[model samples]
Target: MFLRPAARRLRADHPLALELAVLVLALAGAHLWRRGATALLPILSRAVRVDGLVTRGLLAGALLLAGLVLYVGVYALLRDIDVGLSVPSGRDRRSLGLALAVPPLLVGLTKLVGDLTGVPYNGLTMSAYGVGTPVPAVLASLVPGLLVGACSLTVVCQVLVQGTFARVVDGRRAAFLTTVLTAVVLSRSTGGLSAFPARGKLALAAAFVLSLGLALYAVEAVERDGVRYLAYLPVTAVLGLVVVSLIAATESVAELLFGATHVAVLGLAATSYERTHSLLVPAVAYLSLLLAEETVVLLFEAGMRSW
Candidate 1:
């Protein structure tokens, strides 16, 4: 089933001290390395600003390499030392369609509501931007690499924040931290919230009702698709939004919420992985979200140019 939680209870055979020590050491090194690498290549830090194909391709490839080495290395090292979770051989695939399809619709609905009400919710990732991503040449040249790199980066974050930390900390706290950490990491790279409104009383009411409807519909759609635990994705995002609203100033809410939602989506993917032991669920979802998002952006940009 899609979004099913893991059937097994938490195991604690590994030495917590060793696992944490290694993870901390690796993070320190990774931060240093990222600093140096990004200094040499600004594209690593700001991928969305570039429209050129070569720059985008290089950026994707670099992120893919870094993410793969970091995550695969940590996972392998832990597994070798008997401190890691093994990759499951099982697979569950019923949720891919919803995963691929929902992000764009949600984003589009946010866009539509903003157009009507003049207030938009905060948005999500813009690094998915690729000029004419559907163009055969663009698709062949940079899209695949970017898609894979995104998946790699996302998975690495989850492996560290969710898989690793969950072992040492309580699940709820770990989940929250996962959002906090991921928001910090991605907030800069991702663009702001769904878009504007809520400035005026009328606009606020419209945005709220429309957003609520979309949220409710999204959850219902997930349920109708037979997803169980994963349907709570919107609620998880709310948790992130609430926490950020309390701690952050109003201006920063959208960017912070972007990261929170990003983490929530990945959490669903992680749950799928836990239940089935396959990576396809997350990869497909991310790829779809990007394509769907980019398609929306592309058409909107095109419409604006003509308008």
Candidate 2:
């Protein structure tokens, strides 16, 4: 599955360590090349702004690379689970449609609900001022009411009728990766959570619990399509609510608890045995990053002089 020449060479015998070492050496060489004769100097000792575009790009790249590594790792682990994983029939179109549609429908409905109720929904930030209220907020408040409602109905119908891709991935690691990839995609599309009130933490906590329940319900839905055909209902409803809450409840305690690493830990826990639940490892990593980011942002803000 690897496209990079270096990545392919590193994959010769489960050589994950060798792959990492090679990547590090390549990066170091590139840095040295860029710095020319000054490469050996103590440039690494300089303090750097972690929130800058370059840093963001690096983080994004690392995320992509980590995802690739995890995908391969999961595939390797799947061999031990005794389930043969393969591509699903019609998976491409179905997945593409679901991926493209879910975000807009969820985000749109949030905007519509927020407008009618005066509650924050989707990415609507009240504190970020604009010339006569934010234009996006105004549009969000109105258009989604009708458009999103129709789209949601359409998606629900497709999910109920098509019953897409429930058979191809049976291995535990594959299952975990599926959930993680979904969560990560959702997280990126949901945007930053700096707009939420501190009180929204309650909403966030509730949403997390609800998402966990929905994950279980989704498994059941795949199993039962009994005479009632009501299996997908609960899954759709809980997921819908969770999606809205995730986008609207940014910057709250709930967001911190359900962030990327937390989501990964949850997926891993669900896929593995109870005794193997290592959630705290990802929790600590996330908190450390948050601490580092907070330090940099605080220092930068403190240095700014108010006009």
Compared with the true structure, what per-residue lDDT tens digits does model 1 show for residues 1-307? 4222111111223233334444444444444544455465664446467656576666746664665566556665665422223443423445555556655665665556545554333233433333444556645664666465556544555555456666666655554555554443333324422111122322322333334334444554454555534555655665566456536533444434434445555555545544544455656656665565555555554323211
Off by over 4 Å in 1: 1-28, 39-56, 59-75, 79-91, 119-134, 169-185, 188-260, 303-307
lDDT of all predictions: 0.48, 0.33
Candidate 2 ranges with C-alpha deviation above 4 Å: 1-56, 67-91, 122-307
| TM-score between model 2 and native | 0.27
lDDT of 2 by residue, 160-233 (tens): 11111112333454335434433432233223221111233334434443443434344443565462245445
C-alpha TM-scores of all predictions: 0.53, 0.27
Report residue 95 deviation for candidate 2 (angstroms): 3.4
